[model samples]
Structure formats: C-alpha cells, structure tokens
Target: MGLLSNRQRSNLIKSYLYILPAFLFLLIFTYYPIFYAIFISFFRWSTDYPQKVFAGVQNYVEILKGDLFWKVAWNTLLYSVSTIFISMALGLFLAVQINKKVRASGVFKVALFYPMMIPLAAAALIWLWIYIPTYGLLDHLLSGLGLPTLPWLNSTETALWCIVAVGVWKHVGYYMILFLAGLYNVPSELLDAATVEGAGGFHRFWRITFPLLSSYTFFVFIINIVDSLQSIDLVYIMTQGRPADATNLMVYYIYQQAFRYWNMGVGSTLTSMLTIFLLICVAVIFSTIGRRIYYEV
Candidate 1:
C-alpha cells in the first residue's frame, strides 16, 4: 500500500510539472497583460511621466468626448456586421457546393482555401496593387470592357466596402471549411426523409441542413465578428485608414493612439472598452443564440 501510494504521488507530481509551463505562459502573457491594461486605464502615464498617476475616469471621459471615437465605433459595427453576413452566406454556399461529390472537388477545395494560407500582409499588398486607381488590373479590365474605372480604395464612399471585400475574400474559405465539416457530419437519413416528403432543395436546406448546422453557423458568426473587430493588418497595409479616416477601425485606431500618438493612458482605456464590448458580445451570443444552436449526436 505504501509503494502504491508513493507511485501515485510521483505520477501526480509529474502531471503538474508538465502543466506548469503552460499555466505560467498563460499567466504571464494573457492574464498579466489584461490586468496591466486595466490598471493602466485608470492612470495618466507617458514616457515623459513614467510613473502612473491615477486620473480616475478622465481617460474614459476623454475617449467618450472624442468625435473619432464614435466614428470608429460606427465603422467597426458596419465592418463587423457586413463581414459576418457576407462571409457566412458565401461560406454556406461554398460548403454546400463542395459537399456535393462533384468532379474535381479536391482541386476546388484547395483553390478556395489558398487565400487563407497566404500571410495577411502579403494578401493586402496584392489587393493594394489590384485596387490602384489608374494603373491597376481592375482599371485596365474595366477600360477594356468599356466600364468606368473605380476608385476602390481612394474614395470615402467605396473604401470601407473595398476593405470588406478583401476581408471576405480572405476569410470565406476558412468558414467554408467549418461549414463543410458540419455538413459532412449531418445524417443523410434526415436529408433523405425530407426529400421523400417532397420537400424541395431550398426547403430541405432551410428546414433540415440549416438547423443541423446551427452550431457551426453560430461559431462562425462569433469568430468572424471578433476577427472583423480586430481587423488591422489588411487595412493598415492597404488603406491605412485613408480618405479622411474613412476606413479607420477600432484596432487600427487603438494602435495609432497607443503607438503613434504615445497616449498610453487613453489607449489603455480604449483597450479596456474593446475588451468589455467583446465580452458582452460573446456573452450575448452564447446566452441567446447559443441556446438555439443544435448539436447532433
């Protein structure tokens, strides 16, 4: 009995030792940074004044008063909603198509997924060339077809949509894969039963496949919204929030405030606000929509 207890204790110690690194990593990188940001949000700190001086809600007040704050917030909302809707629609379409045992399905899958493998910076750079007003490929093609050249990234009217297009182009494949996995797991018996009842393709999809894929759809919605809110790399590289900050997103604005203007206090406050907003969104999604998502055995 003593020998067995000693062996069990040894195994327990080894298990904890294996998990210690990961626990420490999360603490140092994730929780530590979050707590630090929260603490700094209440202060007025800068390189000039390295010591943090508590300013209560002044940082938050400054953010609320800024005109750019509301503008960026609206821009983020527009970007997030548009991206989620479009991406989910396109992803579902592609998932349904590819799920059909069609010829060259493997090749189609690879081609669709190729964009996701490329780095965001590289993708943005490529899109920047494509969106160039005068000498871009799009312009030349439009001119050949007798259509007017568009100022895709130059005009305030089209800049946000242009970014959304690029985001969709990059992300649709990822969500398509998720939807495809869900589709594959759906029981064919349910589909066949629906078909036998004389349900047409659209009706069957709406009633059966959609309900069964609810969990995946919900997951994709949450992930896409989060990605849209945090979107910066493509916008930074392509538009730089150009045309009078028309394309300015929350994260990009946060980066500018924290790094460009060196307003750490305000930046921290913005970060806290973003974190809170994201948490609220997640909470709402899980509490309300999550209950509706179906999980098949």
Candidate 2:
C-alpha cells in the first residue's frame, strides 16, 4: 500500500491524541503501581526500618509461615465462594421473575437495585444497625416472632457470613440487570418455536433460555468472583477483621499489614500474591469455561 497522505496522517495523529490521556492514566495509575508493589516486595521496609533493606523473598516466607495468613486465606476463600454462588443465584432468579409481565415491575427493579445506589460504606453502617444484637431490626423481628436473637457481627461464627450476605445484597441487583439484558437478547423465534412444540415453561427456559444465557452467566460468574476476592469495605467498616479474625480477608490483611502495622514489604508481597492468584483464576476460567460459552450468530 502507498504511504498515507497528509490528511490521513493528520487524522491518525488526532486519533492517537484522543486516546493519549486514557493511555497515560492506565500506565501511571494501574501499571506503575503494580510494578512498584512487585519491586517493594523484595525489601524489609517498615516503620521500624526506614531504609529499604533488601530481604529477597523473606517477606513472602514470613507470611507463608504464619498461621494468621492461612486463616485469612481460608476466610477469603469462604467469603468468595459463598458470595459468588448466592449473588449469582439470587440475581438470576430475580431477573427471571421480573422478566415476566408483572405489574409495576419497574418499581420492584428500583427497590432491589436501590442498595447498589447507596455507597457501600453507608450500606455497611445500615447493616451494622440491623445486626446490633437484640436492639436491631433483625433481632427485633425475630424476637417478635418468638425466635432467638444472636449477635451477628460480634461473633466469630457469624461475622464473615454476615459480610457475605452484605456482598450478595449489594451486588445482586447489578447482576440481575446483566441477566435481564441477556434474557432480552435470547431469540424470540426460538422460544416461539419451542412453545409451538408444546415445550413447557420450565423446559423452554432450561433448554433454550439457559443455554443462550451461557455467555452472560460466565461473565457474571467471573465478575462475582473478582468482586468477592477484592471486597474489603464491609470488613473494614464493620469488623476490622475482628472477632478473632473471622472476617479477615486477603485485601484487609494487606491493608492491616501495610497501614496498621506499617509492614510495607509484607503488604507488597501479599499484594503480589493476590494479583497472581487472580490472574491464574481468570486464565483457568477462560481456558476451561470460556471455551464452552454459547453465542448467537
């Protein structure tokens, strides 16, 4: 091909210029911090040690040797698994229910999605009140019904689960919207033919609708896992990884190490570990489940 004319060259430069700001943002804010954290992971940098004394994987070894790290890892896994399944299930259910010809469906949608509109910290505070032992709304309702009242967030057995509930509540509506969009995109012709063939509602949904929604389901599943893994706001505001560290997660552990304890090396090591784990998860998911997703051509 011939070289570009002056107008074409000018247009190409303008296009690059249009994208320059966003490129710089990603380079500085995203990529730079990742590399910086990796670089910091090698050193013994803390409040006690102002100078960066190279520790060379000693931080990683320290974290791996600690019992608290394993406890936090298990907690993170439990929270992620519970939140991912519950949120996706509830979201799919709500989307299907609201997709029907129900009256005032839009109002129901808004009511469910309202939690997402609220800031997460504000939502945590709301749940905090709701979980306040016998004086909270939840306990009050249980007591009115002659049921037992238990401390939700102040107990080790229930604290992490309570946070998982919050995670599900906060993000389920967003997932519902995604599933709803997918439902809309399912080919009407296929459903009509299935109906004409005497396929029951459940059968139609199982055979046609669900299969067509595979791509959306996969996307939502990946998003839920990532969100669960990264979530720390509720843990920070409500529990602070307390009640014997029952609600402690990887991200909060990193925060505690870096800020509360001023252990920069350990914090960076934890950050790198989390990032690597997330990458592996995405890679495994894409290689396995992603290949099986159904697409409408």
Candidate 3:
C-alpha cells in the first residue's frame, strides 16, 4: 500500500472502472440466471403450487427416473456424436481439397461458406421443405431414380437422423473455414522438407500436416460438441420433438419443461444436469485429447 504513488493508483482505478461494465453484464445476464436456476431446482414451483415448496433433490430424482428424459438423453447423444464426427470429417476433407489451390478456389470457398450465412431457423425451414413427402425435393429425386421414398421427418427411425443431417449441413461450412485457417498456419517449411525426403502426399499429411493441426482439431471438437449439445433452433422449427420424441434434445427438453409445461423446478434441474454434463465433457477432453495438442513456439 505504501509503495503505490497517486498516479499509479489513478491508472489502476481507471482500469478497474473500464472492466466493471463487462463484469456487471456477465453477472446480471449469465451468472445470476445460472445460480438462480440451480437454486430453483431445489424447490417445487409450478402452476399447481400456490407457493414455492422446498423439495430437495426430488426434482432431480423424478427427472432421472422418467423414461422420456432417458429417451431425450439418448436422442441428444446420437445427435451430438453424429453431427460432431461427420461435420469435422467433411469439413477437414473439404478444407484440405480447397487448400490445394484448386481451380476457382475463391468461388468454391464462397459456395462452401454460403450455408453459414443463413440463420439456423431459416436453414431448418428450408430443409423442412426439402423433406416434405412426395412433393419434396428429396422424394422427387428418389422417385426419379425408381427408388422408394422414406418419410424423412415423420418416421421415428429417421426423424432424428434427418435433423442430424440438417445440423451437419448447416455447420460443416463453419468448421471448414476454421480448418482452412489452421491449414494456412501449418509451416510450409516442414512440408517442403518432407517432400525433399521423398515423402508422398499421404505420408506428408499423416506425419506432418495432421499432427500440426491437432490444436485446431481439438478446438473444433470442443466447439462442435457444445454446439451439437445446445442446438435447438432446428428441432424447434422443423420437428418440435415430434415422431415420438425421437428428435427431442437436452436443451429443447429443458425449454419445454421451463416454458411450455410450466414446470420450472424440473426445468431448472434439467438445466443444472446439462451444465454438469457439459463440464464433465470439457474436463475429460482437456484431460485426455487436449494433452496432445502441439503448440508452435
């Protein structure tokens, strides 16, 4: 305290003042809501109840014991895994092809990223039209080839996969762009040295390019996993969790409990569970895969 001069103290106070707005914004909008929801999960507050009643972990227990919740959890898992892996693979493949300076690369890049320019709700609506039976684009194409058309969005067996396809189509472009950026960051010198050593394309990519891209790959996985888990706009616009709740996801289920059904306690409990699940996912990734990411000096 005695070492700080008046001028230094003024500068320090100004720095704190500058950051105070952002801190207050996060506290009010983000942290407060999260804590409030967790607190609400410990109580019973619904339309049937005249007043809030402390219920302890009964809400959590009831939710866990419900078959619908388990079904929804399964749907969410399938959606997340399918979208993450497929999107990453396609994105990386497209990025690698485009990075080779293919003819009209600029045009191809624009076309690839075009989907990302559309909002998720709009994309869902567009795919909904394409999935409509008989008159839909997909059905028409299948019929033209003398193949039977399956109900894309109306069948329980295919509805979740249909939504998963839409998710992959929507976000693969964004992932491609990120991977493209990472590709540019890979050192050209290393690739050239590998080529001088008689390394073929496969060996060079497997031994050099891919290993160097581990950090970007890890980053994309984290982002895609979170996105797949929380994604609800498409399900909201297209399926609304129809076809026997086959497309119902964790976030959408929480929204249903909190808003549509007016079961705030259960909703909050679901939200807390989702938060914990996300934390565990991130922790596990950091502990395992994240340890191997290579950093450039």
Candidate 2: the clashing residue pairs are: none
Q: Name the regions of candidate 2 deviating beyond 4 angstroms.
A: 1-12
Q: Return the clash pairs for model 3, or none.
A: none
Lowest lDDT block of 10, candidate 3: 288-297
TM-score, prediction 3: 0.96
TM-score of candidate 1 against the unseen true structure: 0.93
User: Which candidate ranks first by TM-score, i.e. highest?
Assistant: 3
Compared with the true structure, all predictions reach lDDT values of: 0.91, 0.93, 0.92
| By lDDT: ranked, best first | 2, 3, 1
lDDT for each residue of candidate 1 in 187-276, tens digit (9 for 90 to 100): 999899989999999998999899989988988988887899999987788877888889999999989989988889988999999998
* Root-mean-square deviation of every model: 2.7, 1.8, 1.4
> Candidate 1 regions off by >4 Å?
1-18, 47-50
Best by lDDT: 2
Query: Which lDDT tens digits does candidate 3 get at residues 77-195?
Result: 99999999999999999999999989999999999899999987788888999999888999999999999998999899999999989888888989999999999999899999999
Q: Candidate 2, residues 12-118: lDDT per residue as tens digits?
A: 99999999999999999988998899999999999989999999989989999999999999999999999999999999999999999689999989988989999
- For lDDT, candidate 1 versus 3, the one ahead is 3
What is the model-wide C-alpha lDDT for candidate 1? Answer: 0.91
